[model samples]
Target: MTDTFLIGMLVLAAGLFAVGLFGVLARRAVLFQLLSLEVMLSGPSLAFVAAGARHGDPAGQGMFVLVLILAAAEVALGLALYLRMARTADVTDSDSIRDLRH
Candidate 1:
């Protein structure tokens, strides 16, 4: 509830988001990118929980749940595409997947 604690939590949230962003930008593999995207989503989820706790409000938690659902859907879709690419073209790098047409 203290300002210091809240600031620390926000900093941590920012760090998580930054790390995930870096991973997404730096990695070329589809799987790593997907994992990084999850991490990115987690950053906001943590921030929402922390803010909700700090303010004694349930809205933050509700937002976190929504974010969780979004992340899950993204993972499912991403994995499906990755699998399809893997099976059909043996491609894992994003740059190599320029065209979907065969």
Candidate 2:
């Protein structure tokens, strides 16, 4: 029963990862892409927790916490860049950010 539950969790994680990847590839807006990237991160976090639980190890939860910290830092940086771009160009779409050499 526990194994089955873990398998289901893994499947859910995979689905989230696929959706996140699709968002990153198909979306045109920078905000959407960032949101998708978070989703991608979530999938792996879920997997880590599930694996840790399956093995009765505390490391999975620890890894998930670390992933959260990393995600927070990434969001902080991404948002700072997004704010700068918005201020400079009033831009939200990634395609318009091509002129990055300024």
Best by lDDT: 1
In order, candidate lDDTs are 0.94, 0.93
Clashing pairs in 2: none
lDDT by residue (tens digit), candidate 2, 1-102 = 388999999999999999999999999899999999999999999999999989999999999999999999998899889898999888898988887657
**Which residue pairs collide, candidate 1?**
none
The TM-score values for the models, in the order shown, are: 0.94, 0.91
- For residues 1-102, what per-residue lDDT tens digits would candidate 1 score against the true structure? 898999899999999999999999999999999999999999999999999999999999999999999999999999999999999999899978886555
Name the weakest run of 10 consecutive residues (lDDT summed) in model 2.
93-102
